[model samples]
Target chain A: MIVWTLLEWLAWGASGLILAWMVADALRVSHDYDEDVLLSSREGEMIMDEPHDAA
Target chain B: MAQAQAVTETKAQPIGLLRVLGPGHVWALGVGIVLVGEYMGWNFSVGKGGALGSLIACWVIGLLYTCVAMIDSEVTSTVAAAGGQYAQAKHIIGPLMAFNVGLYLVMAYTMLEAADALIVGDLVVALAAGTGVEGVDPKPFVILAISLLALLNYRGVLMTLSVNFVITAIAFLAIVVFFLSVEPWNPGAVLHHADLLAGLPYGWLGVVAAFQFGIWYYLGIEGTCQAAEEVRSPARSLPYGTMSGIITLLIAASLTWYVAAGLLPWEYLGQAITPLYDAAQASGSTGLQVFLFIGTLFAASASANGCINDAARAWFSMGRDRYMPIWFGAVHPRYRTPFRSILFLIPIAVSFAFTGLLDQVVTFSILSGLLGYTFMPINMHLFRKRWPLGSIERGYVHPFHPLPAIVLLVLCTATFFATYLGYGVQLLAMMSFYIVASLWFAFHRYKYVRRGDQFTMPWPRPRGY
Candidate 1:
């Protein structure tokens, strides 16, 4: 019984750590520079003097 | 000159299966093979407890999978595509969510291919142990098997389905025979008494623990939707196949559990790595073991081959949409199949097998799948409002108005959390891997579009009824 409890806890603990990492990664991406800004910067450099349609 | 050139380019031959399966049969075969193998393995794990608690855990998880299946059916029917969950989520949510789901699915399927390869290897080693073939390494065998399956898929979907049909029939029969042959019909054992509950080592947590095992049985239910394009009369076939697959799995699982429990004391179940094999031995029916071995081999082969066929098509679709490289979308000149993608999967699957990471692969696959499943109910809710069901509909409506979808959402969220908690660092590492890969690909695609890079291929439009 003790062994079983230990194994279960170990499994849970390992999973928790992974979950935390995933959440942290998601947060980092969300906090980074706005996607639109990044997109416009790249677009401006490439399509200078040319009419760009949004649609 | 221009007119002649255009005519020649437009006359490309169709690659892969034209229309061998009605949606219903494809659904049945897809759901049936995976569920049988999954339940057999899971029951072996749960049946060891011989306690009432484990039995209830098993049944509850089974019920959860049924609910998930119904939700998947609704979503798939509304947004039928080769991309399966990715397409459904994209339609209901947005492109970003769809990209994430697709990314996760590709990772999951790749891992699944590896895990199936490992199972094939393990089964072969076990079978060869008694034979004179001594000291056989299963790695080479696994690699060989996956390679062969990839080649079969590269040939076309019709050939793949034909093989799947034969294997699925044998596997289904084996399950029926195993259930019937077990002594003393005792469905009461599943619900009766308290001492049985105490046998599960996880105590209160056993419920969730058993859920992982139970849900595994219903893992491939969504495969039917992935093959919707190749299926004839998909509208009628898809729904019928989805429902039939779920019902068949439910019946098979219940009967297998009941008979296995009645035949042996529950305590011994866990100790026997292969419960059915042990059961066959005890019954003095040695032939049954051979039957099961062959059945499992076929089941594993069919699943791996079917998955390769389905996954390659999805990659092709993604490529056609300009979401992936044109090379992935390219068809074989003679075969008309997505030969490039099929060839690519072989190495990835083989690499996974060589790494000896079957458990990790399976866990990650399940976790990703559950995440995909969370979006299913949401899609169904949106779809129901947009396109209400007709009076002729025969399926049971989810009770409590919007509550069913809401409940599934909560349940799936909880399961995801539980999975992360259960897998710990491994799950974290995998998620990070997926996020990085998805972002990179998304950026790459954006760059390609911004450059006015002509795809040269025809854009895929949604097929109308």
Candidate 2:
């Protein structure tokens, strides 16, 4: 029973670490450029421009 | 003039969730959860002792993520922003910490993409070989798989989610079938153990070995959190989605291990590349190998696909924040997806796949992840104290007061040490890369980008052309 419990706890702990690793890595790599530039503007004006209608 | 024109056009659109939280976004979240389970099962199953240790490490690491998800949902409910972790960290820990966290996260995700792509490529070759398809180069197939997956995302989030939902369901069913056939009647051998020093170089080293194996099993549980911007009712969906997804993964992993160990001798089990495949074969079902193969392919693809979508979004969010280049945030006019980021991920993944460095990439991912996980427990402690329980309903309190949290923290710290122990110089090399990259970004921002200059335009124009 002790061995079983130890192993069970061990399995949970190990898997948890791997999950944490993937999440951390995913967070690091996936960034978008357009969204950043759009959000960086101080004025709210740029967000509402009509591209097709204006042309 | 082009910049001015672009800005003018940007001001004309109405702010909406349709643009942000599309169907692809939700599918990406599901894919992320499924991938975490698949990676854990595949990579950690290599060496028994190592696999066992990695699982424990993963469990502790997973708890930290759960805490982050809980806090993140509360913040998202209030803010409703696309920045995800970067936004949350900035809100709580300040900008520098948020930037560093986001930076480290991007690095880890990029490597993971490469690693998963390589694994999927290898699996495809093996599967092809089984069917007597000789001399099929893995590189082109890997590129093809990534391209097809990327194209699926390009069609928009709805199509991607529809596909992922089907894949996730099939993968889950396959895991269930694998589990049922094994029938874990003999629980004794599954739980067997020896002295701490037995079969290892040092006594406590055994614990570390177990942790190394166990950690691989728990790799990607937080993929859902990155999609906070895309989920409807992120507060409700995130906590439930993340916790339930993790619990499902845990149950599946434990059962798979228990049943496999019980049904077959460890020596035979350890030798087989796909232990579940062997288990099915022994159970007198010749067709089970085909089932396992198909299941693994879907599982791997779902995970890789989900990571690509979520990680790209994270990049998009960071790019929007000016931590990364603005080009990464570009959404396809028709698809409303971060098309540029997706494109960026494909090349990086292809490069790694061609190199055939799956183990190295996996190890790199684990190291980088541990570095970020160090913040989660601390983030949780801060979150509870600052907001207080009165502000948010404490739905599921972690049992054992501060003890579980403390144990988690200690174990996390020990795992960091163990990572260094197992990897040595390679670990140092990875850490140095993060430190260097972070400092460079900070310097560049300080030197060039103006402080207190808001990057995002608020929704709803203030009346008139």
- The candidate maximizing DockQ is 2
TM-score of chain B of 1: 0.84
Q: Each predicted complex: what DockQ?
A: 0.02, 0.04
Q: Give the lDDT of residue B455 in candidate 2.
A: 32
* Leading candidate by lDDT: 1
Interface RMSD of each: 19.8, 13.9
Expressed as tens digits, the lDDT of each residue in B300-411 for candidate 2 is 7777777677667667766655667765655554345566677667677667667887668777777766666666566656655665555555434444444544655776
Model 2 agreement with the true structure over A1-55: per-residue lDDT tens digits: 3443453355445535543443343343233223433233221122221232221
Instruction: Tell me how far the alpha carbon of residue B99 in candidate 1 is from the true structure, in angstroms, after superposition.
Output: 1.4
Q: Where is model 2 more than 4 Å wrong at Cα?
A: A1-55, B1-11, B14-79, B185-204, B267-272, B391-405, B446-465
In candidate 1, what are the lDDT values of residues A1-55, reduced to their tens digit? 3443453355445535543443453344224423222111110011111211111
**Which stretches in model 1 have alpha-carbon errors above 4 Å?**
A1-55, B1-17, B43-54, B186-201, B263-268, B385-401, B449-465
